[model samples]
Target: MPLPEKEAWPALIALCIGFFMILLDQTIVAVSTPALQTDMGASYNEVIWVTSVYLLTFAVPLLVTGRLGDKYGPKKVYAVGMIVFTLSSLACGLAPDMLTLIIARGVQGLGAALLTPQTMATINRIFSFERRGAALGVWGSTAGLASLAGPILGGIITENWGWQWVFYINVPIGVICVLAVLKYVPNFPPHTRPLDPLSIILSVCAVFFLVFAFQEGEDAGWAPWIWIMMAGSVVLFAWFVYQQRRAERAGNDPLVPLAIFRIKNFSLGNICIVAMGFTVAGTPLPIMMYFQQVHDMNPMHAGLMMVPQALMAFVLSPYVGKLVDRSKPGKLAAAGFATTSVSIVLLAITMMFDLGLVSALVAMTLLGIGNSFVWAPNSTSTMRDLPHQYMGAGSGVFNTTRQLGSVIGAAAIGAVMQVRLSAGDPGHAFGQALLLAAAVLLVGVVASMMADDGTRDPS
Candidate 1:
């Protein structure tokens, strides 16, 4: 049965609310890491582990959980994720020590991984390609906006109530989101696929190795063992791929279906999002650090430096959404990412001078304009030709790559900053780190240019 337009839009709103909560959690912790260190008497590394573990847990199980959404229904899977996430958020808020906080954060990551894939899959299952562009525009903008708002919200909450309030805040929001999903989101018939335990094990080990190696490499001094671990990660990932192929040939369900890779735009889209993921999650750290560490601004003021970018994204999103629905997505996405890379370069240039705060606003506003274009278009176009039956798996793979990229970005930028800070001025180091993200986003721009909406027929 066709859903009434009124009901359909409401469903999207509820899902977006849930989606916003999860993303907000991802970036919120970054701003509050300093507060956690002071409150808990923890070392720098231990405080960072709080954030790293969350990314690890959130990212490692995405492939499996995404398929879980298909085997069960998205509504059921999403509800369970919300419950787990909400409980874990409470645990995070009440923790008396750093260890307990890290443990609770790991649990929170599991809930996040379970829920993340369902959002894109839900949108894919509900909207047609023509309309999906607009739906995805709202969805994508929420992600950029939530991330941009995280530091601001975190700074305010941490300043007013304490760092615990940052986690505590999620408690009510999560509960409300659960109720919203239950009331507004419709449940669809579930698909049945026999789970392959071996594939699961292989994939888990591969992700753990890669994410841990990247995340801990700098902290570990890029030791010989770290290099070995990187090599092992590559080998394990290849083996995982081989195992999936074998399972598929044996007529068993593979963790990742090989068929989805045959879709050109889908393939390109996955790669491109990885690049943007690096930029989106990686770029803010330097800006915040430069403001607080070098310029001596308060946390709240540091966060406000990003307002122009988020505001621009908000203002331009509606128009960009219409463009995605009306025009060629490749050109739009390519142009958007390209514009962002230029902004990043400008940010880097401004970092060389003491005029970071004044100059960065211009760059950030320009970056926001670019985000309005690429974020939604890439999201919609990549899945445009995906078969409905594989929505869960396909969306899962795309998100998994993105999250993997995000964790790596966080790790890589952290390493870059550490090195630059040791070698030169703190302000210059901050700006240098921004350049790495710009380089990555430029790669994404190239990938986006190749992601033609009509290049492949619908499966």
Candidate 2:
């Protein structure tokens, strides 16, 4: 049964709580990196793994988790994921050492993987097609707001209470989400389908190697083993793709539907989202470090720097959502990418040149504005045209690319900073790292430009 208008909003609100928490964890650790390093007596590489491992676990299982939503009921899977997340969060808050925290975070990521797809898939199932753009706009905006808000919130919590509170805070939010979901969110009929284990193994191994190679490359002196691992990741991923095609043809339920890529907007949107993910994930660590470590700002002050970007996104997302339904999403996305890339470039220049806090604030404000344009339009355009049968699969693929971009960004930026740190200038090293994210955003610009721009009427 389709959800009535009155019921849908409540359900979406309930779902967004869980969704927000998932995205929140993605970058929340950024502001706490220094704290974690000091408290746990860990090196930079190990501290970076705290974020990377979460992203790695989160990304690898997403393809299957979406299928789990299709096979089981979304509601059941979502509820279970929430339980896992809440408990792991508790474990994270109490961890005795860095290794324990990283392990707990990996479990937390698994819960995130299970929870993410159901929100999108449920929104698709419940809302009428005419209203999906607006619903998804709200969804997309929640994603943007959560991601951008992470550093701000993390700083505040870490500074006042302790870094442990960052994870501890999720406990209450998770409990509320699980309860609300059980009360408000309805379960759709399940599609009983078989999953391929080989494909799952291949994908997990492929991503693990690729990210691991990047994470360790600089410290390992770009060793032959790193290059070999990189090559092996490519081979494994290529094999995984080949197997997916064969599975689809053989009537064995494939992890991702290859036919979905034929939707030009969907494919292009995925590419753009990858860049979006990459930039968002890649920038936070270096930027946060610059503010606190180099500039001698307290954690609270460092977090306050993100306020402009968060405010702009919060204020502008509703209007952008409307625009996405009424205007050319492709153009909006292109403009957004161009604007974001410029903002990052400005930030990089400011840091590299010691241009001061005012310049950085201006860049952050611009970044928020740019985010408001990208998140809603890109997500709406990408999934709006997908067939109902592929809704779960489509959501899975979309999120996978987004998170995969994050994983890559996290590793690549860390590596870049590690290498550049040898130059003996903290500002220069971090600023150079920011440029990589800026460069990647331009790919989003080009992808958005090439995308189909046909607007769909709300009626």
Candidate 3:
């Protein structure tokens, strides 16, 4: 029984409430890190763990959690995750010490991991094919808008209500989201097949090692242990792949179906998102720093500079989503990537030349426009043709790549900033870093060009 579009919208709104919070937390804590250190009297390394630990826990369990959504119903899994995230957010608010806060954040990350894939998986199952792009466009907009709002909200909340409120804010949102989901979201049947424990183990360990290496590599100065972890992750991942192949040969379902990659759009979509994650996570810090460090803006003022970017993305996403259903998604996505790349170049120029805030605002407006074109189209094209049985796994793989891209982007951009800052003025250093982000978007452009049109016959 396919859900009616009216009902599906409510479910999607419910799912996106949690979705928005998950992404918001990912970046919300960035501006609060310094405040945390001061209040808790924690060392710089300890404060860094506040964010790093969350990413570590969040990135590691995605494969398992995605499968869990398939095994138990997504509704049940989502409810559990909401409870965990809400409780952990409370714990985070009340923590008397940095250690407790870090632990709580890790639990929150685990909760985030559990909630993420089910949204996409559920949408795929619920919506008729013809309208999926519009649904996803809304989802994509939620994702992009939440990210842009994080720093702004963090700055406002941390300054006015204190840093703890950042965590406290999620409690109400989480509660409402959970109730809405249980009421509106359909109870989709679970896949009752037993999961292979070894596959779960290998996937978890492999992702943990890989994510941790990148998360801490720059901080650890690329030490031998980091390199060892990276190598070990590769080897374990290879073994996991081999195991999945063996499972397929034995007629058993694997954690991630090996066949999903055969879909050209799916493969290309993963490639494009990795680049998108890299650009989204990597580009912001330098520009934010340029605003604060070079122009002497406060955190609030610096965060406010992103208004044009957020506004454009929010305004244009729905229309662009309609276009995805009507046009070649690949071409649309490629145009988006190109537009974003050009915007980054413009931002870089604005920074390097000290071209003032007007030009920078112009660049951001273009960026928002580019983002509007990318998310809905790229995601719709990627998963539109995926099989029902594989929806959870596909969503998991899709999300995993995006998160991995974030980890990679954060590490890479940090390194670039470090090297550039040491060699030149803040303007030049930040400008060069923006250039790297611009360069990475070109890869997305190339990948998007290879995607399918994403059109499907009416169900």
Candidate 4:
């Protein structure tokens, strides 16, 4: 049965809460890293793992979870994930050592992997196309707001209460979300074929090796092991492709349909999405460190500084979504990328000059606007052309690439910063990193330009 209008809103609210919780965890731990190190007596590498392990698990399982949601039901998968995440949060709060904390974080990532893509799929399933853009705008804005809030909230908790409160706080909010979902979220079972366990294992292995190489390569120093893992990743990915082709030939349901890429807009749009993820994911960590550690800004002040960007994104995304419904997405995406590139260049310059708070805020505001323009519209355009049959797989693939981009961004940017700091010029090192991010964004613009304008759905 189609949900009543009143019922739909609560379902969306539950989904958004889950979405906010997952995104908030990504950065909240960042500001608390120093505190964690101090409290746990951790080495630098161990401290970094507190964040990296979560991201690692989060990225790897997204494809699997996305498919699971489609095969079972988004509501079931999402509710289970929420319960696991809430429990894991409590575990994280009570963790006795770095090892325990890192393990709990990995479990949290598993829960997040289960939760994240369902948000998009549910929004897509429930809302009409005409209204999906707006729904997505709200969804995108929530994530941006969470990211913006994390550092400040984390800082305050770390300062007054304790870093443990960061995880502890999730318990009550998560309980409310669970209750809301159980009461309001409707279950929709799969109308598709059975799941492919072999494909799932192969794909997971492929992504794991690839991300593991990237995550550990710089730290382990271009060693033979890293090279072997990288090579192994490539081969495993090729095998995955071959297996999918085999499944298609055999008329079996592959975990991911190869034919989805036949949709020209989706294929190219995912490339741009990955690039967008790289740009946003790579910039924040070092920038946060620069603000708090180098410049001596308080956590609240640093978090508040990000407000302009988050606020601008929250304000502009809905309008951009409206524009996506009426306009050619390529031009908008290209324009957004161009604006983002310029903002990154301006950020790099400002950082190089060691600019003050107001100037930095202006730079961030520009970045936020640019980000808002591309983020939702790109997603809408990519999925717009897809038939509803493939929404699950397509959403999975899109999110997978996005998460992959974030993983690469974090590893690459972190490696650069690590290398540069070792050379005794951390400030200039970050400036160079921003320059690289700008170049990446420019590539995203090119990809956006190449996207299929003709495929856009003219509602």
Best by TM-score: 3
Alpha-carbon shift of residue 338 in model 1 (angstroms): 0.5
362-409 per-residue lDDT for model 2 (tens digits): 999999999888987888778777776787888888888887787788
Local distance difference test, per candidate? 0.84, 0.85, 0.89, 0.82
Tens digits of per-residue lDDT, candidate 1, 59-117, equal: 89999999888889888899899899999999999998889999999999999988889
| Prediction RMSDs, each to the true structure | 1.8, 2.6, 1.5, 2.2
Q: Which residue ranges in model 1 land beyond 4 Å of their true spot?
A: 455-459
Ranking by TM-score: 3, 1, 4, 2
Preferred candidate (TM-score higher): 2 or 4: 4
Cα deviation of 232, candidate 2, in Å: 1.5
lDDT against true structure, model 2 = 0.85
Worst 10 residues of 4 by lDDT: 450-459
Of 1 and 3, the candidate ahead on TM-score is 3
Residue 453 alpha-carbon offset, candidate 2, angstroms: 2.9
Q: Evaluate residue 113 in candidate 4 and report its C-alpha lDDT on the 0 to 100 scale.
A: 87
- Give per-model TM-scores: 0.95, 0.91, 0.97, 0.94
In terms of lDDT, the best-performing candidate is 3
lDDT per residue, candidate 4, 227-249, as tens digits? 89889989988988888888777
Clashes of 3: 0
Taking the tens digit of each residue's C-alpha lDDT, what string does model 3 give over 94-154?
A: 9999889999989999999999999998988898887788888888789768867898899
